[model samples]
Target: MSLKYIDLFAGAGGLSEGFIRAGFEPIAHVEMNGDACDTLKTRTAFHYLNEKNQIEEYYNYLKGKITRNELWAKIPDNLINAVINTEISAETLPTIFEKIDSVLGKDKVDLVIGGPPCQAYSVAGRARDPKGMTEDPRNHLYKYYVEFLKRYKPKMFVFENVPGILSANNGGYLELIFEAVKEAGYELDKKVLNAKHFDVLQDRKRVIIIGWKKNLKLKYPHFEENEPQYEILKDLFSDLPKIKNGQGEWGAVDYAKETNNYLEKSGIRNGVCFTSQHIARPNNPNDLEIYKIAVNKWVQDNKRLNYAELPERLIKHNNTKSFTNRFQVVNHKGISHTVVAHICADGHYYIHPDIKQNRSITVREAARIQSFPDDYFFEKSRTTAFKQIGNAVPVLMAEGIANKIKEMIK
Candidate 1:
């Protein structure tokens, strides 16, 4: 039988996707956001259909030929019920337990994986709050995660978080978390892992803590870094059609060029000729000019344009002392910066490298940067999609971790 695992705080199943690709069976996915839940359900349906050789039903849904409800009808009820969509909290603990138990049956959870919302432990969150978000309710979520470890007693667990977590509350919070995990009868190891080292196109660093039952004698798996051999633009983006601001569709659109080795090998383009969510956001004239200037400076001079240095007329914000380097054009010659949830607010920080496009990277572009496959459908509006993509683990990075874990377990 396949190893079974539960994904707590699963955000659109990025980490879970990697595990699934490594042949683990997902017994349950617990999350809070309704839209993210819908996305989880959609992905669950896709996997079920794929297993049964009925992937055509999934393609039909992507092609706008069938409704999501119609597609779910093709999957087993147990498979669909496995996605538990409520928040993980003291108030919802019992109810969440009941939901997870319903699907668990006689199966033993082999692994538990997830990261709590990292906003409380992020540097940006600290800058915004007077107390550095130390008192934020999210800061205490590790207690709930410990509770899951106590309940499941899985052979192993993977805890992911931002690097700032080590410094949160002057590091007391992280210490307490480690104590809790140890007290639960497990030995743990943590390392700061970079997504780029795992073959992800962007540079994303996170705190990865792996814990195993004391009797298992497993230590942290050695993750070998596999750097990209191709340029970010040539391998990751050159094939997508160049649409102007506010141009392109949210659904399936034609690929600008044929698939390349990286696209196929990483499964980013996978069996699809046409891709979805390749649309660009509409930008105003002032922002457009600023975007062009930023792109030109980056592409031509290889220097970032300072927002405070823009022509006086184009400067809108009064506080010019900080955030001057806000507008960043994605570099064509290299990988992108970390894709963050902030992209949902504005594209100023994520301007496209293509001078002609002259806009922030689109929904699909952001997803590709995160290493999601072309056929991975994100439910809801483009803004919500960006949030999900930004908040997710790069599919490739997650898969690398999962593959190593599988080897360790075997």
Candidate 2:
């Protein structure tokens, strides 16, 4: 029998994509974000909640709103046949249970997989509040995940998040999650996975918590070590038409030349670079004029300077704790760093090497690095697009996990 799954907190359907590839049919998905829900609807044939406010009328309402054009235009035809959207929350587990009961009625879902928002435990966020408190309210949501597991009791589940959750407060949160899983009558195994090992060029590390009903005697699968080398920026994006900063085939644009130059000088090439404001000049302007001048002056003053000779002035300027510090470049040669939501605001870590500008990485390029196929349409607007990409699990990584899950299920 084909396995069936229900995805909670499904962001851009990364987890669902993996499950689908692994041969599990996605019956229902619950997400709060409208754009993400739209993307999900476009990609799969699963029943979805309507855009309406009322819960009972959601499915009917969506039937009218989801036309072939709207759905097909946003998602590839291959992935559109298996999605259902439910606008619900983990807090409303009873309602979700009722919906599932109506559809599947006595049939147990084979798998449940989700990654709740990690902002509370993210390493990139401020570690402490003004009172020097370390606790973030968002940290408590993991309990909700456990509650859902208790209510639905899927045969298996996967919980994903950043590595910081493992060592946060010296493993307190990790311990809490483990205890909750134990209490839920599931045998749990946790591992930190690097995306590069699973065909992602970027070096993103995430923690995956896998659990199955206590009666299963299956062992946790090991992540295979694969060859590190793969296609680089030149290989992946060489064929696409070049769009200068603030320009793209799908209404995407390029950054200023100055921004591009900065990234190029820093050894960044290919992929998108983000900028805070798109000040329309005759050309893309590098906003860091003063910093660039200072670096040049320092370099000129020391004629004997080598790569090591570049003064700390440039380093300080680059590392300054300001909005400009957000200027980042995503290197095309290796795996990308984690795609974060704030990446669009500044390119601190995501600059492009080819361009001589200080622009942030674009949503499309970010999605590409995350192993999203080129044809996966994103809702318009850079911010929304970036959020979708950032929140998505790397599709390739998900495929690898799916393969493992399939083996275990069989």
Candidate 3:
């Protein structure tokens, strides 16, 4: 029988993609974002649930209250364009659970994998509330995940999140996760894995909490201590055409020829810094001065730029003006700094090793570094696309975990 799995909080199907590549058959995915749901529908056979209204029995309850035409009207036109569209309302959690139960029945599911939104516990957040102690009510979503695990009783699960959870309230939140899993009748082992140790060219470190139902006797796989012999940014992106920052799309090139020409005229050959309204320099005097001069000059001169012309949806950098100051150049020959969600908006630190342009990383380029295949289509809005890519478990990293799961199941 084929290994079966379900992905919850599946954003852009990154975890799904990893599982698929590792030979698991993905049956269903639950994602709240419409654009991400569209991306999932386009790529896989899995059902995309978008229903946002409460209906006791989705099939029977939604009957005459809204006609087919009326129900269609309720969905956004952009959402209608998605391949496997359905409405999934937050209030309809009980209905969703029923539907999922009906779908799985008594059949065995090999795995249940996901990383719920951890922004509430993220170190990047401004409040710095210790881990596990989230002021945001949304932090309780973990309880829902545990409930799902108990109901499904999958052979294994992989819960991922930021490293802050370890030290958050001095490991209180991490302990809560352990207790919850234990209560659910699973043996859990937690480890912080660096993406660089795998084949990922970026140096991102994330916590992977692996839990196995106690009845299944399985040992955690030991990660190799030796780094891969050959890993570099150029290796990841060599085939694509070299356009200055913000120039190329997958098979579609948005060449800013005039901008390139202007840069050539100005003796600035590296690349044009893609300007963004959302990006502000840190409060530091020197950083502020540099950013102000750069922004003023770029705006005043009408400098040709690659991604600068894109709408606000394509870019959202940290509000701090000194973000650039904190940026440390990655040794091009070595692994890059951790690819974070914010990297999508601010490419200040992710500059090309060979190019001089200071533009943010392109969505495709970032995806490539994250080990997504070239054919994998990302949604149009740049920021959302980047968030999906940055927040994903590296495909290779997921593959490693999946392979281990495969061994235990056999």
Best by the lDDT measure? 1
RMSD of each: 1.0, 9.1, 11.9
True lDDT of residue 278, candidate 1: 92
Model 1, range 107-224, lDDT digits (tens) per residue? 7888999999999999899999988797899988889988988998898899999999989889888898889999999999899999988777898999999999999998999988
lDDT of 3 at 1: 77
Q: What is the TM-score of each candidate against the true structure?
A: 0.98, 0.74, 0.70
Candidate 3, residues 44-112, lDDT tens digits: the string is: 421122234322222221223433344344444433432223333446567657656666667677888
Candidate 2 residue-wise lDDT, 92-204, digit = tens: 66776666666666667788888877776676653545422256666766787787678778778888988878766678888998998889999989999988887776788
User: How high is the CA lDDT of each candidate model?
Assistant: 0.89, 0.61, 0.59
Model 2's TM-score against the true structure: 0.74
The top-ranked prediction according to TM-score is 1
User: Residue 241's C-alpha lDDT in candidate 3?
Assistant: 46
What's the lDDT for residue 81 in model 1?
84
Give the higher-TM-score candidate: 1 or 2: 1
lDDT of 1: 0.89
